[model samples]
Target chain A: MEIREIIISLFYLIASFLFIFGIKRLSSPATARMGNIYSAIGMLIAVVATLLNKNIVSFEYILLGIVVGSAIGAYMALKVAMTDMPQMVGLLNGFGGGASAFVALSEFYQKIGPDVAPDIKAAVAISISLLIGSVTFTGSLIAFGKLQGIVTGKVVKFPLQNQLNILLILALITLIVLAVIYPQEQIYYLTIIGISLLVGVLLVLPIGGADMPVAISLLNSYSGMAAAATGFVIDNNMLIIAGSLVGASGIILTNIMCKAMNRSLMNVLLGGWDNTASSSAVSGGKDVVIKSVDSEEAASIFDAASSVIVVPGYGMAVAQAQHAVKELMDVLEKRGISVKFAVHPVAGRMPGHMNILLAESNVPYDKLYALEDINDDFKTTDVSLVIGANDVVNPAARSNPESPIYGMPILNVDYSRTVIVVKRSMAAGYAGIDNDLFGLDNTFMYFGDAKDAITKLNNELKNM
Target chain B: MSDLFFMVYVFVLAGFVGFELINKVPPTLHTPLMSGSNAISGITIVGALVASGALHATEHATLATVLGVFAVAFATINVVGGYLVTDRMLKMFKKKK
Candidate 1:
């Protein structure tokens, strides 16, 4: 190898080590920010090293693309609201996937000729890259649309939906085979791309908004796999190592999300809440008694309590109530009341979503506890203040086997001495099933928007 | 064949390292972890750079250049946007005095 090649390889090796160390630092909150910076630096080194490659003959296009892409990316990073993070991540995932697909397409175009074709291995790698990359690109975009309200969040189903998806997969496999056998044929490659794109849409369309976290996680994994496939086509070790790392991280996250909801990967992929009909029927048959409380009454209940645990959900996100909830925490703590937050694994649209929102509100990280760490604490707590959360804190998940969400782990807010639930109305949650926590004997429903309710409750607490 | 075998060895070992490192990340940092790793996956930008800048003496050279430019741009967005967003989120996590 030439001296330049050796230097570039050494830089890549250092970057890979930095990537590993950066992720290792993520195990603690204190060092996580620095960890992200470390990874960014590693990326910079890798990009610079690649630019030194002898094969690159020009610099104008690279410069233009970097400048334009960086400008748009910085704007998005600065302007997006914290509540819209899930969709933002999903959009970026799509971009990464799309780039991988383009790389494969470019390679294919460069290699194709009248009497020449790519090797069998290159052909196979290109096909896999195109297939996975297209699916991740379109699927992530669909997920983003659902979260951003550009598309309906409801499960979109059609006649023969499953059958059509099956047929598409079969056709995609056949096309992939044909493309590999006749690497010179562009028609087969294009057909495979088309089918894969359609399959991406179909794969995500049936998944309801609540299951978006899982879908996004899975798609994130696919994007990495696509990048790795591209690495194989290009025979680049840097891309392979980085891609596999991301692929593994995404898989672990997907599994964590699936386990949080007590569902299999296949179940989430096949479209969640399959028993909605029977479960809703079972929950709606009984008219349970519920007690309502105003902010004044709720404030008094909180005032008397010594400890409170706040449970936040997607509704809190919709109401943009994290700041207000933070204000409530301040008021409570000022009165010598200890306040902590209990976050269910599947509380919001994405994993760790609620924690980020809470963090944005300037709540201390140490005060937020995961479900397992604080689930039993509710039994001794004075007040469990549920903010715009329903299914996650619903008691049915524990006590009722007939409920659709029966097996899912939930925050045991119902066990608190006084359970205060703030919500807009008695509407069913994303699962379309009644939350029995609202009707529990110790529970007091505070009906209003989370921000408005929390603000009013804060006022009452302050005036007292 | 030996080169391919070596690549597979690197892939498998790197995957294991990724799994071990990521499993240690607390649940609170899961979002940042996702976005951070997502940024790393943008390493495919290396391929895009070569595709766009490498001089090709072929009938499809222009087409390859156009596609490569787009890939570079898109991958740049993924890397830049993902890392910055993750940093923004991670900055919010703080411990009380």
Candidate 2:
């Protein structure tokens, strides 16, 4: 009935609109900055609305909460390097889960009397929040540990890990039953949280370092659901809606991200046979020796090529060589030669790794195609330029039964008449496996920074 | 029934339809999107918001209050950081077609 309440509510509406617009702009890497602004404005609105609410037990703590949170966030946004984004994400995700579970537990304890309606609702909200929150928290910390190399990123499959995890799941189910029947039962509450935490750890153990990005996305989705569940318990329509939107979008992102890597959800969640074999891929003996080439000598091939396909990988991103690579593409295109970029499903630190690199260089979208679409075409191509790509292009995926990426699809760069691999060294990819294609007869290894190598290739091509 | 579950429903479906916008979105924005979403996903603060006064006996209330502070603090970090990062990332593009 209050005018200010209505106005505050409208403000949230505006914020929601901004969120939509932000997500839309985010559709294009070019427009992503705008999207962030829109979403932030929406959040700003939501915050102001929360402050405006009459139900607050106190204001100082709330304001303090806002100030402290924003300070750290601002630093991360401005100070953290782009390469460290995954780690930053893991840390932030862990914090989110921690917050949600805390809220749920607090609410449950603060309102457990049979007479208080608010406490009852709070108790219910925190229960679900605690369950999902614990999972997100531990899972993200493990992801961070893996990325930071604090823990071995190899899939940790302890004996009976699966069976132990199943028992934890059963314990969680029992706790849920107790929560519904007894409602205020504290023992059930604590046990549920513990089981959930265990579930989180177990869930991520089998996933190798290669799948960190997908796991991060999935945990992010879980965090959102935890938030939305909290919103529902509180009867906060805006929180529920916003939480759900993020939850939904995060899941979509994880799935899309996984597909780009040609990984299935079941495989990722269950930590199946696909990634567990990562240990074997790390050879005890230097199994295959690979030869390397300097930029100058490699340039000769580029100068003579009629058609070239640039295959991108994580190295291109780590070195930030998109512009230089694009320069190479431009010159090659001008010389009456066809230049197309071949993107592997699971290239770079995450999915869309190659696409991101190319998009940054302002490469046209039409010029890029997935491995399946372009593999057949590689055989007819005059030259294949492999730029820092590793696992995605590994021929082992095609023939080796013992290889980890086997049965998984790959880019057919080997089929090309001439294959040029540009890498710093003949080191293994993220999967830590030796690339057999590195020593193949048709493959010429161009050893240097991808940007420098591509730029030199451009220089040599122009001279011709 | 509530909008939260419905939104979750949308996200779940979107998760499966991962093929759609991902291919459509470019790398220029993917990093920003990832960080932004990570930040937004911090909305888990709602848990603490409800926890502030949600306990039974006086002892339970005291415990809930202590935990509630952390819940709110953590959620605040997630929401504020998520929104601002996403916004800042989006703001880099001053012009739109």
Candidate 3:
């Protein structure tokens, strides 16, 4: 082996190790940033090694790609609000799939002559990469659009959507087989690519906004597999290793995300189109209507409370109230009042969303409590300060079987002696359903920006 | 290391890099996803597959071809299996309430 080759291989080994460590670190919401940095370095190493290799024809394109990619990446890192992270992820997944698809198409373009080898091996690999990559690219883009609210995520459920998708997939497969046999038929592959791209749009079309995260994760996994298939096409070792790594990781993430909501993967994918709530499930929905509390009144609740449990939800994320909340927590703690964070299993849209937001504000890890740990305490607690929270604290999940969120666990904040809900309005969560917790007798709504409310409360407490 | 190996390395390395980007995103379920992906990334058995068929100096061309076919089959299984499981997991989150 050449010296450079040895160096590159060593780079691969080292990079792979970082990926392992980075992934391990990511398991905790705390070290996830460091994990990401390590993985980034590993990728940098791998890219450098690939550039060192002889057959790239033009390394300058790789450099050009890097300059463009890094600029976009850095801008996203700096400019993207934490609230837009899911949409950003969806867009990035699209780029990955598109890149892989382009690479496969380029390879096919280069080898389309009459004498291009009978090497069905290369043909099959490239075809698989192209098909999945094109589909992933389009599907991920659609998911991003929906997440960003640029497009509605309403189910455009047609008369035969599933059947159409199956037919499209089969047609693409058949075209690939014909392309493999003909070897010179460029049109067949092009047709397959076009059809696959359409199929991608169709895949995400029926999926609504609520499931965008899952759609994004699944597309991320597809992008990984597409890369792996490209690895096979070109006989590239790094491609296989790196692609499989991502492909596998994306899959695992998708599953855990699913479980967090207490739904089977199949139920999430195929069963969520129909309305999850029925009218009978919610009785006298306003039996315990909560009146919105102002800053001064909310202050009184804070001052009187012996213990305050802050239950964060997606609304807090939208308002970026984490730091303000953290500041409020410190003030309460200093005042000899107990402050604990109640984090539900499926709080926010994803797993550990609350933890990440709080961690970003440098909240103490010890102050955080999972739903089960904090649920019982709320019954006796003086005040449950639900910040921009919704479905996670709903009582319907606990009692209403016909409800969409039935069987899904909640924060049980209703049990608290006094429940203060902070939100902009009575808008539902990502599930687009109303929360019954707002109607509880013990609950009081605080209508306004969560950060502003917290700030007002802090000022009032300081005066006291 | 031949050019072939270098290309493969780049492909896989890109994989790891993307992994970091995704990992760093402030998603709710990084750990379980990480654990799940680690189990799937172990399917890099695709490397072993190619190695088995590509390095046989004494074998006839036909035998080499057969081994190559098997290698492709095994690697494809790894690819298909890995992707399918990941797809299934992602689909799990679609039922958001």
Candidate 4:
């Protein structure tokens, strides 16, 4: 190898190290920013090294591409609100997958000819890359659409949706076989891309809005798999390493998300559109009895509380209530009441969604506890304040067997001595099930926007 | 190992490393982790560069070039946007004074 080649290899080695080191730092909040910096530097080094390599014949197109890409990326990074992080991640993941598919498509187009027969192995790799990448690209866009409300948030079910999905997969498999056999035919490749794109839309459409967290994580994994396939097509070791790492980590995250919902991977994949509220199996909910309280009265209860646990959900995100929640926590803390945040794994639109929002609100890291850690404390707590959360804190998950979310693990807010719920209405949650907790004697419903209610409560406590 | 087997070996080992590495990440960082990994997936730009920049312009070069430009642009978007967003998010988690 030439000296330049050796230097490039060394650069790549350095880049890989930085990537791994950066990811390691992400394990802790204190070091995550440094991790992001390390990874960005690594990406920059890799891009620069690839550009300087002898293989790139011209810099014009590459430079133009970089400038355009950087402008858009910077605009999005700077302008997107923290609340829209899930959609932003979805769009970026889609772009990554789309880019991989295009690379594979171009490579195949460049190599195949009427008289030429591409190597079978390379053909297989390229086909896999194109298929997986296309699916991820379109699927992620659908996810983004759902999150952004551009598409319907309800589960879109056609008469033969699952059957059609299976047919699309079968047709794709047949095309792959044909592509491998007749390497000179471009028609098969085009059809495969078209079919995969359609399949991507079909795959995500049946998932309900409530399942966006699982769908987003699954799409993240698919994007990684697509990149891995692209790496195999191009015979790039670094791409393979990075792609597989992403692919594995994404799968693990997906599993964690699924476990949080008590759902299986196959169930999510096959479009488990769970509308949990329609089934009125909660025999305990028939004799509707609810204790409704105003913010002033709730404040009095909070003031008397020795220990308080705050449970936040998607409603909190919609109301942009994290800051109010933080203020409430502070007020309680000043009064010598211990306040802890009980976070469910699938609490928000995506994995760790609540954590980022709470962090953005400047909540202390030490006060936030995962479901398992804070669950037991709810039983002994003087006040359990549920902010815009229903199903996750519902006793239905533990008591009602026929309910859609019966087996799913939930925050045991009902066990607390006094349960205060801040909600927009007594509407059922995404699971569509009425929360019996609202009807419990110990639970007091404080109706209003979560942010407004919490702020009111905070003021009430202050004046007292 | 043969070339095919070597690639498989790399893939398997890398996957194990990934699983092990991610296990330590707290739930709080899962969003940043997803965004960060999305940026890494942008490595497809290498393939894009090769596809677009042929040593000599040929009959199919125009098509390849156009596709390559798009590939590079999109991949860069992932890399740049993903990392910056992740950094911005991580910054929020800092301990309050």
Candidate 5:
């Protein structure tokens, strides 16, 4: 009703508009960078408006928090390698969730009084915030640790893993109901927080590193839901709108990742690869024949090729081979060979991860094609150069029903006229299944690290 | 009750808008989209600012301030680090002639 309150409300409205506009611009690469800047400006306006609120009585702590946080954030933004992006994003998601929990906690503390019972609505909101926020906080940290190699990347499953998660959910619901009935009872709220944290860890711990993309995406969604819950606790529309927007984006990405792997969301969440043993057993018994090639020999194939498609995987990331791959593309392109990158949806640790790495190497955005767009082209292509990718390009996903990765969509590099795979050895991919593509008659294995092998091949090409 | 209904309305509408907009983003920009949206979720910093600054002379004032300060710092990191990292990634996507 007051003039000042109306002004702040109007500012929030404008900020929301900017956020919507920014995300809309992100639909195209040409405008995506500017979109990010637009969102940042919106954030600035919201923060300033919040500072202007009459409820805020002090500034010292706020200033201190901002300065310290900004320093660390700037350092991480500048220092993180492109390959470690999944981990960085996971860590950031954890912080956002943790912050939401903390905000809810502070709100609870402010209202804590022996004689005073919080309103039922506020109580429910606070409890929801604590539960979702704590879960996202701890869940994202575990996901981060898995990707950062601080925790084992293997699928760590215990007996009754899914049952235990279900039990935890049941308990959380009971606790939430208790908190609502006895709004003054801090015990119920605190217990909810603890159990939620435990559930977060347990939920993510069983997921293997290969499935971290989906986990991170899901956790990203949780973080937004947490923020929205905090918004409900604080009765802030800006938080609600922004949080829901993020929640929706994360869900869309998670769905895309699950579809790419041909798995359901619940299957991924319940810890995939339960049939790894049986599937690998089926493929392991056979000694498939493979044709090996040296860098010079591979170069000759490239020299004769008119069109080439490059399929990059996590191995390419581990070898830091994006730049080298870019170099190879250049050499091939110079010889009048058309070179394009075929990036599978689940190609790297996260969604669109391979694209980011390739982009970092100055690969033209227009030249990098998604799986669907380039899958058919491989059939007519002269040489399909696979760089450190295994499961994604494996033919087993299509032809073998007994394989663990069966039915998953894969790049049809096996259909190319000549399939050239650059890898360290015959090691299986993250799924631990043998790749039938490697043994195909048209496929030639170029052994070595992705970077070293690509560099050598470039040398051979230049000398010729 | 009316206010609650209003907030719910806004939340549902915003979610729909998000879905429509995100569905349009090319797979090429998915990573940036994730990080950028992650930064926007840091809008909780507004709540954190109020929590930290609106301290009264209550018994739990110190405790609340500590929690608020941590919340502000964490949310700030999400916003600043997320946006900066996203920009770093987006800057790499170039079109060659």
Candidate 6:
């Protein structure tokens, strides 16, 4: 091998190492910033080495692309509010998918039948990249829309939707077969791309807002697989390595998220559950007895409590109550009460959303525990303060055999001595099922906007 | 070994490494970890650069050039935006003083 070629391969290897090191740093809150820096540096090394490797005939276009791309990226990155993080993540995934699709399509355009032989392997790689990439591109856009409120959060379905999706997949497979057989047919390839885009929309449309975090993670996985296929299309070793890493991590995260909710990946994809149906079903059954309390009364209970567990959810995100809750935690801690935050895996609109929210509010990392880690602690807790969270703490998941959320792992807030829930109303959660916890004798609902209620309680505690 | 076989070797090894490294990321850091990986996956910008320049010699150069420009832009957005946003999120995570 040429010395230059060997050197370039070494750069790729070095870049991969940095990427791994960067990801490893994410294990702790303290080192995560440094991890981002390491991965960015790794990306820098890879990009620079590839540009300098003597393959480019023109640098002008590359330079222009980089300048324009960097400007827009930097601007958007700086402008995005922490609250809008999920949408930003969706948009980033979409861009990655688009790039992979374009890259693979360009290669196919440059190398099909007339000049290059109809290599079946190349054909397979190209089609797979295009398929996965286009789906991710559109699916992620829809997810972004949902998070951004440009699209309705409710599941959108039509007659025979699943059947139509099946037909689309069948057609896609047939086109792949045809493309492989007649590699020169550009029209067939384009048609496949179009169909894939439609399928992407169809696939994500039926999924309700409650399942969006799972959907986002799944699309993240798709984007990784798309990049991997592009790696095969371009015969780049680094692409495959990086792509598989993202793919594998995304899959693992997605599985973790699914297990958290006790829902299979297939169920999330098929999108059958909706809040309206579940809520209606819940209200239809036996009447639920709720014990409602004012924030002042709850504050008195909180003041007397020896220990408290604060569980925040998507409603907390909606009400932007993390900071208020942090204040409440501080007030409680100052009074010699132990305070901890319990986070469900799929708590917010995306994985780790609640953690980010809590962290952003300067909640101590040591005080935050995952569901299982803190579930047992709830049993002996003086007060389980549920901040705009439902379903996740529902005892029905543990007690009711017919409950929709029956098998899902939840924060055992019901076991606490006094369960004070801060919510807007007694409405069922996104699962639409009535929470059996509300009817429990020890459960008291403090109804109001989460931020206002928590702020009031904080003040009340201070006055006490 | 065949070229494909070598690529597979890299793939399998990297897959293990990625899984192990990522599993270490606490749930609090999952968003940032994902954002960081999103940037890493933008590694395809290398191919985009090469394709754009290489296509300058072909008859369908214009089409390839357009696609290349877009690929570069999108990948850049993924890389730059992703990394920056991740840093932004991570910066917000403070250990209580």
TM-score of predicted chain B versus true chain B for each candidate: 0.97, 0.66, 0.47, 0.89, 0.95, 0.91
The regions of model 6 sitting more than 4 angstroms off are: A112-118, A274-284
Worst 10 residues of 5 chain B by lDDT: B55-64
Writing each residue's lDDT as its tens digit, candidate 6 over A295-409 gives 7899889878999999999889999998998999899989999999999998888888888888888898788899878889988999998988898998878877667777899
lDDT (Cα, tens digit) per residue for candidate 1, span A116-226: 787888898899899988998999999999999998888887898888988998898888899989999989988888888888888888888888888878888888888
lDDT, candidate 6, residue B34?
79
* Candidate 3 lDDT tens digits, B28-90: 444234323432332323232332233333323334334333333323333333223322222
* Model 3 / residue A35 / CA error / Å: 3.7
What are the clashing pairs of model 6?
Answer: A278-A432, A279-A432
| DockQ, all candidates in order | 0.86, 0.37, 0.08, 0.76, 0.86, 0.72
Q: Score candidate 6 by DockQ.
A: 0.72
Q: What share of the true interface contacts does each candidate keep?
A: 0.82, 0.43, 0.09, 0.76, 0.85, 0.73
Q: What's the C-alpha lDDT at position A384 in model 5?
A: 96
Clashes of 6: 2
TM-score of chain B alone in model 6: 0.91
Q: Candidate 3, residues A1-464: lDDT per residue as tens digits? A: 98987887788788777766766655554464555556556655665565566543333333343444445544553465556656655665665666566556555654555455336866777788779878987987888788777778675567876787789878987998998897677688778789989988888877766565566667768867876776777565656766777786677567756765667766666635356554434544444456887888888888888888999877788778888998898889888999888886555544555665676676766677876677789888889998877766778778877677777777778888899988887766755666877777788888888888888888888888
DockQ of 2: 0.37
**For model 1, what fraction of the real interface contacts is kept?**
0.82
Estimate, for each residue in A124-208, the C-alpha lDDT of model 5 and write its tens digit.
8999999999999999999999998999898888888778888999999999999989987889999999999999999899898
Ten-residue region with minimum lDDT total, candidate 5 chain A: A273-282
Q: What overall lDDT goes with each candidate model?
A: 0.89, 0.69, 0.64, 0.85, 0.91, 0.85
What is the TM-score of candidate 1? 0.98
Docking class of 1: high
Stretches of candidate 3 above 4 Å error?
A1-7, A28-34, A153-156, A270-273, A284-288, A349-351, A430-434, B1-97
Model 5 deviation from native, Cα RMSD in Å: 1.2
Query: Which segments of model 1 are wrong by more than 4 Å?
Result: A275-280
Name the DockQ score for candidate 3. 0.08
For residues A37-132, write the lDDT of model 4, one tens digit per residue. 998898888877877788788878887888898899889988998889999999998998999999988888778655665688888888899999
Where is the poorest 10-residue window by lDDT in model 1 chain A?
Answer: A274-283
